[model samples]
Target: MIEVEHLSKRYGSAPAIKDVTFSVEKGEILGFLGPNGAGKTTTMRILTGYLPATSGTARIAGFDVHEDSMAVRKHIGYLPETPPLYPDMTVEGFLHFVARIKGVAAGDRANRVQSAIQRCNLQERRQTLIRKLSKGFRQRVGIAQAIVHDPPAIILDEPTVGLDPRQIIEVRNLIKSLAGEHTIILSTHILPEVSMTCNRVAIINRGEVVATNTPEELLQQLTEGTGYELEVEGNIVNLTTYLQRLAGVRGVEQLSNQYLPEHRHKLRISLEPGQDLGRNIAAIVVKSGLGLYEMRRVQASLEDVFLELTTEEKPIDAEKTIHTEPAVDSASPASDSVVEAAQTTPTTSPTLVPESTHPSGGEDA
Candidate 1:
């Protein structure tokens, strides 16, 4: 299990993350969903004990990340945005090296390395050199090294940054498969990753946690319920006025008629939460002498929820009061310094620092 409370981080005078709070239950995959420069990586680094928070605390498997950094490191596995690898080492050799550095006993090193190789599906390439492998396989090698020590918790920051669609799906499936056995915190800007892979999501914006809940619960709580789209043929001058007056109807808009036939109009109806007016709408259209040609339901999507929460300036009234703050450009020097410090930190001791913390030295996702 993982717990974070009021975890704040700052670089000089500017704040990177403020009052951030969330938790992950055992065997659950939590998606830390946010845009670039939203302090996702900052939080991940602090939780992994690679960086210390300005205030508050983080605990993994009941050990404090700051006060008990060594114990926390032993209990969790970490993968930075770029996979840290030895270009000359074979896949099996690399995992074995990582296992030994992670304190795996000499007797258990072989079994742990094999298990990591099998779980990451790198059998054929086990003997291949890391530099010779494709980017996708290299990513699998990254994950294999993370699990090689058999830690109870794993932290991944942007695991599928540059992979193609097929590779992304493969990596996604691999992360999903590790859910029950290991608690995971997947940090990503990709929307589909959260809805498809995580059981719960925490949406962060402007250095603050905006909302936290399951995908379905957040959609239902923050958005207007389902609506309808209809195509009708009639003399419909006051159709919108009538529809707007109907109970449970929130609003109605006439769509573009550019492609529609003459005298045929397309309309979209917005509905209040928990309201179903399909039967009433049909009956009213018939009574009004309009020939209803088509009617279809439109459900709210995760994209809709994400846009609404991030783009708005006012707080949304819901189970979790949406937090709002002045927008801070993610590319500012303040944020860059924190990232630079994490990347440039020494890795003299593998147990104290994750393997090759800044292998690629690329910008944060």
Candidate 2:
């Protein structure tokens, strides 16, 4: 568990993190998301005791990060943006050294080192020098070193950044397997990674936490009355035009690629958030005599939430037409409250809403 209160960090004159506060729950995977220079790495550094905060307080499992840094470090395993490694050392040698420095008991050091190697699947490369290993192997080496001591929490900063797709998947599965046994804070800009690995996410923009909740809660917060995509065999007697006139129907997109020539129109319909447009849209297609091939809800994802939070409010694109049936009277604000944080200070992120927070559009329900 972790807690930050009124945390801020300044570099000379400008702040890198400011008045940022949040908690990382036990056994939960918390995704730390933000654009470049979002202070994600900076915050992690402070929590890991790699860097000291400019102001405020931070606590790890009830130990003050500033006062009891060594105690805090004893319970946290951190893999930074780059894994610290010795190019000439073999995997087994490196892990053994890490276990010693982390204070593993002399009698248990061999078991601890072996456990890390097995968990990271480095058996084949145990004798290979780190500099001679592949990028994926190097990443695994970093992770193995971090976990060699079996710390209670793991901080992986961009663990999949340079890996190929398959390598990324491997690391992802590895991280997922570590959860429940180790609390993790996975920091990355890749939305798909968070969706796959984390239970909860905190969208950090301009150095502040703009949004925080379970991945599903965050998606559901933006999906109410979003849209539906339907692929069908027929335009069928003007059904598309008629569906446009139905209540809560905002807009329709017709896909016109050469790949689908049989009946040709694939409709992507936008509707009032929270409205049941699928059943209504289906009825129109049936009544108009069109053959429906596939229909499903198009939920707004984590990317949509990140952009909406990080990007400042701007004028709508002029070429795009705005369509809407009506605003749902059931709309609710984004979160529970904006209470004063009780922990450490952090630097501010560059791209975000103004200092005075604005109400978010959808309800989590």
lDDT of 2 by residue, 1-365 (tens): 87888888776666777888888989999998888777788888888987788898998888998999999999999998889999999999999999999999999999999999999999999999999999999999999998999988889999999899999999999999999999999999898999999988988887788888988777667433377777777533255556565666777756543577766556677776555555556766665567787887776777777777788974353223324332322222211010011011132332111021112211000
Which residue ranges in model 2 land beyond 4 Å of their true spot?
Answer: 230-245, 250-267, 285-296, 313-319, 322-365
State residue 45's C-alpha deviation in candidate 1, in Å.
0.9
In the order shown, the candidates' Cα RMSDs to the true structure are 16.8, 13.1
Clashes of 1: 0
lDDT of 1 by residue, 1-365 (tens): 99999999776666778999999999999999887778788889899887778999889999999889999999998998989999999999999999999999999999999999999999999999999999999999999988999999999999998999999999999999999999999999899999999999998886799999999888888876378888999865445545655666787766766788999988878888776667666655765578899998778877777777777664443222112231433455643443344334332321100010223232231
Best by TM-score: 1
* Candidate with the greatest lDDT versus the true structure: 1
Where's the lowest-lDDT run of ten residues in candidate 2?
334-343
Q: List TM-scores for all candidates, in order.
A: 0.83, 0.78
